[model samples]
Target: MAENMFLFWGSGSIPCWKPMIVLEEKGFGGYKNKFITFSNKEHKGEDVLKLNPRGQVPTFKDGDIVVNESNAICEYLECTYKDKGTQLIPTDKAKRARVLQRMHEAAANMQQKLVLDLLYYFFQTKEEDRKEEEVAKKVEAAIEELDRWEAYLGETKAFVAGPDFSMADVWFYPIIAQSIRMGLDLGKFPNMKAYYDKVTARPSVQKSWPPHWKEEPPMISPFKGRI
Candidate 1:
């Protein structure tokens, strides 16, 4: 296996955490991690920008090759280092399709609502200036998405895709953690709540959790009691 694989990533970014979790699951060898600071704009510097024109964290470089998108980085590692780590996408043909289907579904149907429609309200608007009705509307939409995932997990049991901990879980766990940290009531979705507990307990997830999240207090959810 090749070494000197560099990953530039920012703490607390769910997208960045995907590859961090993937690297950890891949035994943390053949790679060097370079943590970036969002506050300092390190991700916007020439080095990262050269690798990722978008200047985003989770920009990965393997020798001369560069992979920017988080899910794509995970897929790259899974494909390139297939024999080096645990099989993330699964080998069975039918199961592989199911896993990949749910992976994209979780990103499109769940992550978009949770991050963009819901959390962005808090990030972009001050609490004092926020309109209660608008926040409630976004919360309602995000909950609908969560409900769909909760139902899926309730049926899947062991992981997001199925019995194995595959790429779907790798993609889904970080945002779910952020959702809870931002104060979404895990109890509202019993299956997801339990799944959160199980996944976070894993060595890779625990290790890859945002460093700042451990040192600083969790962020308060904008939808506190309304949702």
Candidate 2:
């Protein structure tokens, strides 16, 4: 019997969405999912704060073991469930090194540059908000990074890790999807545009995306007036 697993998540957070995608790929459908509402400050409540002192969403509980941090949760899932299907982290030294390198890059570099910047522009509505000029610079920098990813895709096969959809791709696809939702023109990077369409079409990707997401307006950038 599978252990009772649960995930505490927030609906609008890309970090939470990352693990949701991984769980779908792992083919574990019987686990429970509980939403921690950001609007209500539910994540800061005692129960959630115990699991993650930072009170962030995307926390996981497997039986008695608790894990926080999106990337760490992904690594745990892949290791604990190694007998299940594909190994998310390759055992080969060279491939595994590349995988770890890329995963860190995506989380540290691309995510902050693209996803967080767009989040501020689209979600935060404070009057003291920073000027659009700063936002544009960040967006442009993110675009340059996307071009680098496109170049990598052109040189590789299969997915980000080559020949298989590993955790790197799992980590990557959601950020890209969020970028699309924020109205970034993916078409500017033809390879990435194609890759985006390809990943979202996967059965796992389809399963993880919330129903409300479908009804929301397609991500468009107010900067460009179109995504």
Candidate 3:
């Protein structure tokens, strides 16, 4: 079958993985996925730059319509292909609102504070030169925020938003998986750990797992010593 869409993506990128998971859940298995490498700055090359001036991965094209940003692409797919495959956005009004709320929280709060802040400490600082106090506080704050999500999961007893798999799971899974790559202890959050096992067991998530991660060692957290 001919591809209905084209996805420009980078391996192991949380943002890029979002739409890919959506596509998988949508079961558009024949769609094209063009892998770009940050090492060679391939995303910055002419083709991708023309599609997305920012030259970011997760640049999506379905015929003449192009979309950027992970969440936007997921939303577009959910709306555009709603009748075809798995329904990512819930049909019930209250459930839909909950999914959307968690989606935004995943991006605005969890991704921003937990993922990016720790990444800044890791990539931007050398071990010998690291500031112990400041990094420790950031790590602690991230864990505290994560614990809140853990509590939510324990209460909800199903997926991120509720009993069904929804956009909230799509948004939450990648960041948490990447944090696992960075050595965030899911063991500290039992409900989150159980949730992790359930999500990772999904065929879509397994298919979308970062290719490079299988070949690489778990990243040593920059706050390893402090924590």
Candidate 4:
């Protein structure tokens, strides 16, 4: 059924991981996928450029239909095959709202604001250009945000939005897992650690696990303090 569906993705990319998980959940686990190496700049090649001008993986093609963004691809799969496998988006109105809220919250806050913010301090800045004091302040702000999520998970003890593993968990599990892989210190946030463990154990997550991560571990933390 997913024969014409093709995905150009990068290994260990959190955004790239999302749609793969969605495809697996939607019973399209056998969809054609080619890994694009980031270091090799393959994403910028003509294949990806034709589908995604931004040169990003998760340049997905469903027959002639193209969806570039990871979250949008996941949404497309869920909407296209709502009844095939897992019901990612909940049916209940309030529950659906919660799922959507958490999904985008995870995207904007944890993934972009917190994770990428710290990553910029490391990958984007030269050591000679480092500002210790400024980076420390950013780390503190990130810790406070993590604490809010920790409190939420500690209170709920199920999924990000509720008991059921819905689209919110699909959207969120990778943030927590990838954050830990990138050295967020699951030890600092025990509740989030538990949440990560719970979701990581799910079949969809395990099935779609980044192929590269198995062979090479992600860069570890130089900053381990919880702040």
Candidate 5:
């Protein structure tokens, strides 16, 4: 049953990493995959477009079923492979709610601010057209998002949702890493820094760590050293 799974993924993308970590956690580490290069715009190709209309990586398949969004793929894998490996979505009602909240929060709140407003804004906007006031606010917005997580982790103690490592950690880990890679200083957020360090050492995360990141991370981030 597990053998039919396939993933189209690009290195260093948070969206791509979410499902890859889920696959590894579900003990499907050797599942078939094709590395789609973002630089080459391979994700926009016809093959990926067939499965995902937006032509995104982390276009995941399990036999006849296709799950395109990263969070959706993680949920599908958890619901399908509940017994194959770690149980990510806890059965407890209260815990399950918290897990779900954090999972989506990583995307809705965290990614929106960090990727879209901050880094993507920095990269996409032309230098001459850049306005110092708007850029400063975006940077601060990213910092405020981190402040939210820092406080959340401080309360949760071990992982994003609770003490147990669950689907929430699977969702949040990559975004946290992306923040750091973009030159967001972790020194100001102790709790988030601890969470980052702890998740960094997890086998599921380590084994699926983006290949390009290991070889060469960008020396310069779009942050312009502000983060």
Candidate 6:
């Protein structure tokens, strides 16, 4: 059996979903999950803060090692579990460089934009408190970056970095899925819409999304498949 693993996560959070998707894709078994509640300030509590000083969701514990940062968690899984399943970060130097680049872009750029938009619009403390103009600007920037992703897809096949699904896709999928949930219409970008549909249909994604999330109608649907 695999070593005992624990993941600290919040329901429907993109960062949390990244590692969860990686774990499912790696087919690692025997892991435990602790669901943190943002509403209750569980993430900011002492116990979780000890593991993640930033007080972020998706902290990971494996044996004596505790890791925070979603990308770092995913990278650790790839290296530690390299022999367990399909290689996520490519072995080739150039290919791996491209994969890592895309992963960073998705994390630093795309996810940031989506998070800002969601914070301003859906999760704002008051209806009037929502930053309508700022949200629109951020959404436009996000769409521009998403257009680059679509172009990247057009140049490649099957996955983001290359022919096979890699960590880049894992990083990208959850952000897009959550963005869709926040009412970003995918119809404006057909390629991205198609790519989003393809990723959400994966069994790994289906498993990563919380059960409660399934009850809500998808805010955006680029394909017939339910996410």
**Best model per lDDT:** 5
Q: Candidate 2: deviation at residue 181, Å?
A: 0.5
The CA lDDT of each predicted structure is 0.85, 0.76, 0.85, 0.82, 0.86, 0.77
In model 2, pairs of residues that clash are 181-219, 183-219
Model 4: residue 222 alpha-carbon error in angstroms: 4.9
Candidate 1 local lDDT, 1-227, one digit each (tens): 33668888899999999988888888864477788898899999998999889999889888888899998999999988877667898878999998899899888877888887788878988879888888778888888888888888889887889988989998888888888788777768889988999999988888888999999876666655755
Give the lDDT of residue 103 in candidate 6.
89
Task: Looking at model 3, report the run of 10 residues with the lowest lDDT sum.
Answer: 218-227
Q: What is the lDDT of residue 207 in candidate 4?
A: 89
Report the candidate with higher lDDT, 4 versus 5: 5
Over 157-218, each residue of candidate 6 has an lDDT whose tens digit, in order, gives 56788888899999887777766665566776677777887888888888777765779675
Error of 2 at 107 (Å): 0.8
| Candidate 1 collision pairs | none
TM-score of every prediction relative to native: 0.94, 0.88, 0.94, 0.93, 0.94, 0.85
Candidate with top TM-score is 3
Candidate 2: residue 44 lDDT (0-100)? 92
> What is residue 71's positional error in candidate 2, in angstroms?
1.2
Clashing pairs in 3: none
Model 3 spans with C-alpha error above 4 angstroms = 218-220, 223-227
Model 2 scores worst on lDDT over the 10 consecutive residues at 218-227
Clash total of candidate 4: 0
On residues 19-112, what C-alpha lDDT tens digit does candidate 4 reach at each position? 9898988888889988889999999999899989999999999999999999999999889888899899988899899889988888788776
All predictions: root-mean-square deviation over Cα?
A: 1.6, 2.5, 1.6, 1.7, 1.6, 4.0
Q: To one decimal, what is the Cα RMSD in angstroms of model 3 from the true structure?
A: 1.6
